[model samples]
Target: MTDRAALQHRLEQGIATLGLQLPAGAVPRLLDYLDLLVRWNAAYNLTAVRDPAEMVTRHLLDSLAILPYVTGSTLADLGTGPGLPGIVLAIAAPGRAITLVDSNGKKVRFLREAIRSLKLEGVQAVQSRVEDVQGQFDCITARAFATLADMLGWGGHLLAPGGCWLAMKGRRPDDELEALPPGFALASMHSLAVPGLEGERHLAVIRHAGAAAAPAAC
Candidate 1:
């Protein structure tokens, strides 16, 4: 088998073994994405992991672990570095509209190429900081992006009245939770069991109450 085929096999086995439910059709697209990531990293340095096997285990499965907790018709990825759960979620949830935002122009350009190469629909990558972007979204996500407090402060205005913030973190951020403003409430905190990832992974689902309750303060 070729490298991609082996990677696919590992991904399939890993998902099945981990008992994670993934869109059946997304596997191929993910393989294509991994291939592109590896190629682009040579010039753009999109990710540190170069091995396809490691990408399948670390990046792909780790991203998919959040699949169960996300709820929204549309989603935006804040600080979408190389499209980590954003692109993965877009593939896993094809029906949802996904917009990936990033400050790095090179990364944004890579995201656009990945979208096109993967044949992903309803996905767009924009090169802009979260503060500069306009319009609210049904859901927003950040994976290893910022502190809960900072993400809340920056992403607060972007959430639709009843939208959610899906923040992926390594350890439980108790302090960040305590520091959160009043308007947003903790919807749920799902501990993720990612295949091949040995450390802690938690997906925090936060709901926006209103600006009155939790004023967007710097």
Candidate 2:
């Protein structure tokens, strides 16, 4: 069994080191998610990383690293596999309603269970092609979904007016930015310093120049 107290302390330390201050109640929720992820991974193969310590450092903490820059009321996660940043964002920002979108049925299944088992409110999992979904959101996020161009092509429509896309990329997305179709401008880029992780990570915040529409068109 996982040591709950140890997990809580680790999460606390991770956030603190990253210069993030989360609410006191977020710890239990984080612990609950870590537990569920471990249990479900055994059956669903949701993730390859099975060690709880590594998961805290890699998945949960890494996801939370982008939380400080996410600006939105309701967020949409494109190609969410087992709800990385989406579920973590929902838990971190309790008031933000998050919709987790994925094309894989198995991943969506795991996402549904994660949402249910964690009793995560304001979180809905949708199994659909990212470009086919129709809904305007305050923010759109994708982690390791695809190349920046493809991700933006599919998920760009989901952004609401005056909203932005928080695409987490490893290195600077210069080539991907060049491939962007139109009406999008680079807003800001945040170099992520994930606690206990090596190498460089970044969160590219891109904004639309014109009005935003639903994700029905690529």
Candidate 3:
């Protein structure tokens, strides 16, 4: 099979394993986005994972693994290099408004192209630091961006009242959870299982102490 075909097959299997019900044509669009990333990465060095098959597993699947926990109509992905969950989530949930924030000019340029080429509505790529990003979102996502305390310290203001912060980590970070900055509380810690991926993956769900309570499971 050709590389795209093989990647499509693997993506289908992975989405099935995750039990996600995506809209029609979503998978194909996602594959096309991956193709763009691969093409851009050749010069920009976007991601370390060069292989498209591995990108399906490590980037696409890994990002979509958090779909179950994503709620609300607006989301901001801080430090969204190459738009991991940001771009992927925008494709999966086109109705929601997604903002991909990154300080890197090259990555932001790539993100803008992806948004334009994909014809993705309600999605914008902002070239700015996490702290400088304005507007509160109902949900915020950060993938290995920084420690829980640090992420909150920088982008905490961007989360709307009652909004939730979903931080993706490689392993359970008990220490970071313990050191959570004041005014924020740990809502939950979920162990994520990305299909075909080895090693530990965890999602730290956090919320403001004064914010309204979150629904169960997020």
Candidate 4:
């Protein structure tokens, strides 16, 4: 059995280490989400990180590491397998409207249950290819989803004018940056420090070429 209290302590410590001041009850809600993910992951193999304690740092903190860069009232997470940053973001920022998009049916089902179980008000799950998702969002996130070129190529239309795309990557994607399609430019790149996690974690902040640039440092 997973030790819920221990997991919650680890998550809380990580949140403080990141210097994030979430709203009341956000911590417990995040822990609840973690528990749900762990339970669902057991049978469905939703994520590679099976240990709930490891999920605190690998999943929760890794996702929350990008919270500062996420802007706008509406956000969409593309290729959101098992609702990594999508659900985590929703729990942290209750005011923002978040949509989780994925093509995998099993993952979508888990996302739906997560939303229901968490009682997240402004969150929704959509099972559709990233290219086919409708409507525009002020912010879009893609976590190791695809090559930057192809990710922007397929989901470019979904980012509203003046919006930004937060691409979660393992390292600075120099080659992919060179291949960004027309009308898009690299705004900034942030080296994320996710507590208890090793290896490189980078957040590539991209925006329309014509749009005002995001703050240079994030």
Report each candidate's C-alpha RMSD, comma-separated, in the order given: 4.3, 4.2, 0.9, 1.7
Q: Which tens-of-lDDT digit does each residue in 53-171 have in candidate 1? A: 99898889988887766676888999989999899888877888899999999999999999888888899998998888888888888997889888888878898877778889999
lDDT of 4 by residue, 46-136 (tens): 9998888899998899999999998998999999999989999998888889999999999999999999989999999999999999999
Deviation from native of the Cα of residue 177 in model 1, angstroms: 0.9
Error of 4 at 202 (Å): 0.4
Clashing pairs in 3: none
Q: After superposition, how far is residue 4 of candidate 3 from its true place, in Å?
A: 1.3
* Model 4: residues with Cα > 4 Å off, grouped in runs: 215-218
**TM-score, cand. 2 vs. native:** 0.91
Off by over 4 Å in 3: none
TM-score ranking, high to low = 3, 4, 2, 1
What is the lDDT of every predicted structure here? 0.84, 0.84, 0.94, 0.91
The count of residue-pair clashes in candidate 3 stands at: 0
lDDT score for candidate 3 against the true structure = 0.94
TM-score of each: 0.91, 0.91, 0.98, 0.96
The regions of model 1 sitting more than 4 angstroms off are 210-218
Q: Name the best candidate (by TM-score).
A: 3
